[model samples]
Target chain A: MTDLPIVLRFDDVSVRHSGSHVDAIHGCSLEMKEGEHVALLGLNGSGKTSLLMAAAGLLPHEGTIDVDGIRLENSSLAEVRRRIGFLFSTPEDQLLFPRVLDDVAFSLTTQGRKEGEAREESERMLEAMGVGALANAAPYELSFGQKMRVALSGALVHKPRLLLLDEPSGALDPPGKRALAALFAAHPSAMLIATHDLVFAERCCDRFILLEAGKVVRDTVQIGEITL
Target chain B: MTVPHAHPAHPLARLCGGAILLCGCLVADHTTVAGLIVLPAVALSALLLQRTRLTSMARLMLAGTLFYLPVVVLASPGVALKGLSAAIVGVATVSSLGPQALHDAIIRMPLPALVRLLVLQMVHQAEVLRRESVRIHQALVVRGGVDGIRGIWEFAKAIPVVWLPRVLFRADRVGMAMDMRGYGAIVPAARSVRWRGIDFGVVFGSLGVAVAAVWFSALVLI
Candidate 1:
């Protein structure tokens, strides 16, 4: 009978791959408010994507990434991951299940639901995301737009509290980019999207953080407060 | 405490029964050749499950058979003709069965074993092919050879050059895709969960049937 207070806070967090001399990121921190739409903008290799990955707990990092005041470490990661959904760039890489239904269903496997319940949930989510017909299609057969939609559904089906997306409009065309901005507007989950698409960053995100060389260059603009 | 399967209560039973059948048959070996005869029928059934265009499958089968004929002949030397015939029959059986039975068979298997199977059979084979090609290319590069197999001079010189980059490019793409999907990165931990006594009984019963099949098949065949 209590609401889960979902919060994500990063403090002095940096990720250095094992055996690498140069850190991917260095001493960068940000706190995401509940239900905030945040955009991460960076020149290539500025560690924006790395920061998002660390926040999602997809990669190991030093310092602390706190989810709702609890830091990411040990068995707590499972609980943290349960509350966060993540998508890596490249549909070719991220969407791997031979069939679309299976890809969506695979997201539910960890939740340990009955097959019927899982199937229903998967179908409902796909339909809601507007890729219902793709349930039987192969991931390779999908267009860039369709794959984006499928990946979104897979990330959202469990209804996670935080959604992390890397390069949401990287490969998309004009209409596709517009559609994605629309998708972002409709979603309820708190999100951190890392991208070089400035137009997309402007339209899709309410708060923008510009990153440069493993550090924040400017924390400017609140789209919700100011007109584009 | 709960499982992914809809009819969760009988999971171990189903797994035990299925494993007993497949492993029992594999161990039964040559004696289970009769069981293997059911392979074609099963392969054909896959067409139904996938709803494949039968004509397309037939074309693929014919092409596959032709390609396989020489390899089977070369591998089995003395009995090439006989073994090749048997192998052709074997492919037909497997093709008919489709992959559903195999899917069912695999579902019972432990997750690590399933992934290991994919890596060993699929990824490992790709790796070996690429490694061998790289070695051959290095040899050609060292001998002051013009690299390609285009326009005679360019073509011959290109053969050594293209294969490495082309194969490597594809592998990189596939590798990135797998990594994004959490392949080999997420390891499933084994947890102790209790099941009903019926689950235990069903599994044991499956094991018994498997033992009997192998024992009886050996006695009869020998």
Candidate 2:
């Protein structure tokens, strides 16, 4: 058997958006196995979020992103997208549907669900995330924490194989963070979290990778990094 | 009494509300159309009463209305009053909640049927406008700009790139989130929604008023 159980594999990835002088990230490679939780740590401008986005196939970057033997580069995005759950740091940007129900339902519908099925599934997902109460609420009316829950519910609605979170715990309070950590721990899907919130990275992710200049820097986080 | 928190609406409420709003605009008499003035007043009053601390939207709405009045007057003086009244009513009807809930209500309708509405085109106009404005507003929030500016130069600078990333980012997240949610994966199981007595009363009650108004308007004009 191969020595790796990587559910996700990135090789020699480099991304240069249209007219940028320097590539946003260059030559970054990593492997993540099933049930493996990984943290991406870096300061702003360190390319942490960009790398996560690339892995999630949200952006067009030159690299081989393979999820479960499916290479994202040449593979159909529809299929790749179904297998992945992605969230952005900016909750407002992440929540596209104005209505919480519609937003959550968007992911469900994308997976080829009929209207009725999509609605029910969206409701269930919202409930599981403990924000079902806000299911009919307006996106703009929600507080940042509530918005994050809605976004998370939207991400988890389809329950994809790979879960990608970008600083999910940022706007949350301590209790809220812990609640999210517990959810991550209990979730069956493999997770890759991009955050400067080391506390969250420590709690939700089992493995840690510090990214600098679009490259993997120090690999693995120590126990000292764990702080509630 | 403790104040009640705003909640997500029934799909019927959203669908009927939107339909009535649109139809009412097409047919309502001047007064009914004008009931909308109460909408902004209600919004301000509700905000005042609830006393939630956040950025206010009242001034923005006023400014928008003020900016458009002359153009609207110039175009259709007679319909202007009716149109203004109708708009006021529509706005008031939906406030105390936000756009997302109404959208969710729309989604709650059967998918095939909803798709058909868009295919018919006119419904898509309202749909697209809703999508566009919300998308733009979200972008403003994300870019950390567009918070009701005062300075002319700052406003000028903010005009071009205002809320672009937020709009794009929100658009991106919408799809990803929807897919993961498994929306439209299968026929949604039917869920029961019990309308309060008032809700039923509201529906039939509004229908009666609309019918009466239509008949009366036709009779009077003849």
Candidate 3:
């Protein structure tokens, strides 16, 4: 475990939105090793989302960030994205396609997979997520929990090495959260989950990192040791 | 929930029917009674078959009428009537076809990948905007932002200021999600839908209606 290679690295990364006087996340540095599950806990507006966005290269950042040894630069952005799966806080924002199956298969289709193959793989992923019956349904037709499951299927279907999930269990019931925790437990990828659900985070993550006022306040293996 | 297609026709067939109806509306001289009657008759028939929601249809009609109000004010009544008729036909055709059907048809069309992608994105973003607008409207109503007609007017006035920034932010988030998912690296493969007897019926039926309407308008003119 000690010899595991780093999956994600952030070196003094700072994110500042345009026209803003202050940084969203300032001097944020962290490392995630292969197959590690890390919980990113913070109060609202504490830059948890901003840090995840910066890692995904979705925001302009001051310092360097690396995914699977590849720097998050313009030239390598596409390649880096290939190795990462990002789940937006709002599932509706990411489920762009009309049909559930199509939305799940979109990642694979855009990666040049054949339609039949992509659909088949998407179906399998949906089944695993317990939303197989929803393949033909429209995204707008789904319940919040179902939508979250479908969105998670879409994120996981491509088998990305690093999973960046923002509030994955935000709208779930207790059973849904447990199901999601189980799914995360089974996944082989490294995950950086931004969440306020301490129980959920504790279930799925081995390490906890707390952010306060755009900076990492605590990093520890014990969840009970971190203060929100 | 599975959206039941109002008719069993394939999406492409429905699209073709819509195209014919639109063309007929554009070409037909709506000043004539026969020309004006043809489109509404065809559109109404289609809408009936599709079983579109009455409220949705009414909303679309109202929007269309409002859009041509300037024509009614500045131009001749006949010109405004023509514009309104065309608008009605356009709305009816789209409503009858449904958004999912339209999406399916466009993705399978022999168009440039970028054009298809742009159209798809526009359709998706429109839905997003509508949802966001509804949410904001509900929030305002619950927060006592709407007390009476005056409050309603104020809310309407604040739309551009309150809504635009949120829309822009959501757009950015959506764009980031797309980029992260590698949306443009390759053209997505559209699943092929087989044509049924109803599809043929729709296409031929629309063609016949369009041709007959044009011929009838010509005869009336003569």
Candidate 4:
């Protein structure tokens, strides 16, 4: 396990939102081994989202970040993003295509794959996520839980090495949460999930990193062993 | 999980039908009674075929007519009527065809790649804005910002102040998401839609209507 390659690394990173003077994430550092699932736990505005966004190269940050051994920089941004799958807190924002299948096929199509091939792969992914029946349905017609599953399908379709999820359990009911946990457990990609649901984190992740005011306050193998 | 239109008319057929109807209306003299009759008739026919609720259609017509009332006063009633008729037909065609179907058709059309992309992006941003507006409106209502006539007025006043910033922020986030997912790297291949017998009938029928309208207009002029 120690010899496994690092899938993600954030080295002394600080991030400030545009037009804001205060940093949302300040001097945070962490690393994840290949296929390791890490839960990021924090209060609202504790910079869990900022850290994830920074690692995805969505926000300008000081210091360095790496994905799949590739540095996150303007020139390397595309390559880095290609190696990571990002899920927003609101699934609506990520599911852009009118049809569910088209949305799932987008990343592959953009990578210059043939349309038929991309769609075939997307259909398979949707089937795996248990949303195969919704391939032709419009995004507006779906229930929240169904929409979440479709969005997850879209994220995972391209088969990236790492996943970055923000508040993934926010809209899910208990059963939906459990289903999501099971889905993550089955996927091989390393994940950095920013969430408030301790139970969800415990079910899917092997490590927990708690953030307080943009700093890593706790890093533990067992979340139950630590006091918040 | 089925699409809204279980057996939708082919998108090309819908597009051609709308275009033909619009052209027919535009070619006829604004003051001609036949043109006025035909325009509303075509719109009504489209609405009926789409199974649109009568109450909703009436509400839309009322709002649209009220919006063009200024044109009736400032320009001429005939010009206003023409504009209203065109708008009605446009709306009916869009409702019948569905935005997703329309989008698919437009992308597949023999247009330049940039133009297709521009249309797609515009449609997407419009949807985003609409969704945000609905959310903001609901929030306002739930928070007691809406109660009576005065509340409605205040809510209307607050829209620009509240909605614009939120929509802009959301648009930025959505754009970032798109970029991260490699949106513009390559043009997506168009999906093929099955055409039916009704599709051919629609195109031919529209052409016939357009031709008859043009002939009728010429006869009236003579």
Highest-scoring model, TM-score: 3
The segments of candidate 2 whose C-alpha lies over 4 angstroms from its true place after superposition are A1-4, A73-75, A96-141, A182-186, A221-228, B1-68, B72-76, B82-86, B92-101, B104-222
Q: How accurate is candidate 2 locally (lDDT)?
A: 0.63
TM-score list, all predictions: 0.62, 0.63, 0.87, 0.84
Q: List DockQ, one per candidate, in order.
A: 0.14, 0.20, 0.65, 0.58
Give the C-alpha miss distance for residue A60 in model 4, angstroms. Answer: 1.5
Cα lDDT of model 3 by residue, B1-222, tens digit: 113445677777776776776676667666676765665665565555345578766776687778778988898655765666566665665656555776788788777998888887787677667767777777777787575676666668768899888888788888888888877666666666788888888778877877877776555543
Which tens-of-lDDT digit does each residue in A205-228 have in candidate 3?
Answer: 999999998999999999989766
Residue range A30-74, candidate 1, lDDT tens digits: 877777778888788888778877776656888888986778886
How would the candidate models be sorted by DockQ, starting from the highest?
Answer: 3, 4, 2, 1
The 10-residue segment with the lowest total lDDT in model 3 chain B: B1-10
Q: What is the lDDT of residue A182 in candidate 4?
A: 88
Q: Is the docking of candidate 3 incorrect, acceptable, medium or high quality?
A: medium
lDDT of each: 0.61, 0.63, 0.82, 0.80
Determine which window of 10 residues in candidate 3 chain A has minimal summed lDDT.
Answer: A107-116
Give the lDDT of residue A25 in candidate 3: 94
lDDT by residue (A76-114, candidate 2, tens digit) is: 666777788888786755565546786788677666777
